[model samples]
Target: MSDNWVVQNLQDILNRWNSTLSDIWTLITMSPENFQGGAIWRIVLNIHGALQAIGYSLLVLFFLVGVVKTCGTFVEMKRPEQVFRIFIRFAIAKGVITYGMELMLALLSIVQGVISTIMNSAGFGTPQDTVLPQEIIDAVEDCGFVESIPLWAITMIGGLLVTVLCFIMIFSVYGRFFRLYMYTAIAPIPLSSFAGSPTQSVGISFLKSYAAVCLEGAIIVLACVIFSVFASSPPTVNPDAAAATMVWNYIAELAFNMLILVGTVKMADRVVKEMMGL
Candidate 1:
């Protein structure tokens, strides 16, 4: 039964492709000029414009945050706990920003899906329109696939966003990991003004805790990456397959970021232990 479903789905896709080809052929053979301006093109252009805007926005935001954190680090040298607190604040802020960006992406995906469905329904008249053994072809053609955005445009935009987001998310994870390490590395350094204060040992203990937290983050990222790689390869033919793949990839990336946090904690612990000879 499952095999039959797969076969049916494949046929549907083939039919859609055939219809698309036929449309192109007709356009080329008929006027050739008719392909220049169309609603499909406009839809595609709009999507591209929106994505470019989003990307730029994220890049600027990341940079601004970096500048602020750097300034805080330099200015807060007299108060060690203040520096650590700022680090924690930055981590939380970045996480929130990332989550919000993801939510926006999700909304965009839904919009794209709806647009595609509408286009598919309207019947743009492509070549593959006729090849799908009639029954399947009719079912697909009648189902509203034509009302959606052109396949080429959709594929291009979706691919671009996925590529960009994946890289940015991975970098974000790495950044967090590095920050965690920094905090841990400096853990044993006393925040107190007095050189011979008894409270100096507190710094060592803090370092150990910080390292442990980083180690936990490292483990999480490793697990996420490993599982995601296995789940999505050898691509399936489902309509939702691309989205699913992106979802899993994002998950893995998030995990990777967590792992970095863990690594920071572990490093801090090791550094403190060595200092204390424990």
Candidate 2:
């Protein structure tokens, strides 16, 4: 906090941005069981349990359908080898529906390993915080009362934009977490489709979508890591210029970097889907 309104305004914006960035990093790395103390996850588990009963009923129906469709004749079904193959399919499908939550969590664990590898290789223990340049502060402090007017206007607009971007970035991360919960809660219905060969595509697609959701975190982490490295070297400013011009230049450059990072986080799901060919 500074006595000068211009410095204080910019400081507030940077503080908000740094806080938001830190939250984003923490959210992407946390498991559903650890997120928000797992309260939401407990509700999700209860929902999954309730759905599992319905999944079992549907599982029986699908198993019957598979038996009827795959066995054109009673003689075919009576054959020992045919019976064994059909039995195996039914058993495997039942196992999938029963353990789908675990399966999904396992998938998530694998993707988290990828994120960890990325962070370790890049050697970023934490995100870099953006700082106001000393030159800009000195220049603003030295300004006459009349000359400070333009700088005041510049800081106001820049600070507002920075604040807006911070929320957008954080909301994107929150949206990802909600999707994870949604997928876990509704998993049983689609998982029941695995019992029938003709309907197995539904289960396959569901798994792929869940995987894409899990992998989205990796994309977000990579974007933030790159942005952190870029932030290490602050935006270049002209010390010889007027205080207003220098502040405007710094704010514009910093905002652009933030925009790119936020944009990447928002598009993380799309990126994962494209990679998955979904």
lDDT of 2: 0.89
TM-score of each: 0.27, 0.96
Q: What is the C-alpha lDDT of each candidate?
A: 0.38, 0.89
Worst 10 residues of 1 by lDDT: 188-197
* Candidate 2 structure quality by residue, lDDT tens digits, 111-165: 9999999999999767888888889989998999899888888888988898889
After superposing candidate 1 on the true structure, give the runs of residues whose Cα lies further than 4 Å from its correct spot.
1-149, 191-201, 229-278
Point to the candidate with the largest lDDT.
2
**Model 1: per-residue Cα lDDT over 156-236, one tens digit each:** 443444345444444444443344434422322222101112332453445344444333333333333333343323322
Best by TM-score: 2
Error of 2 at 100 (Å): 1.5
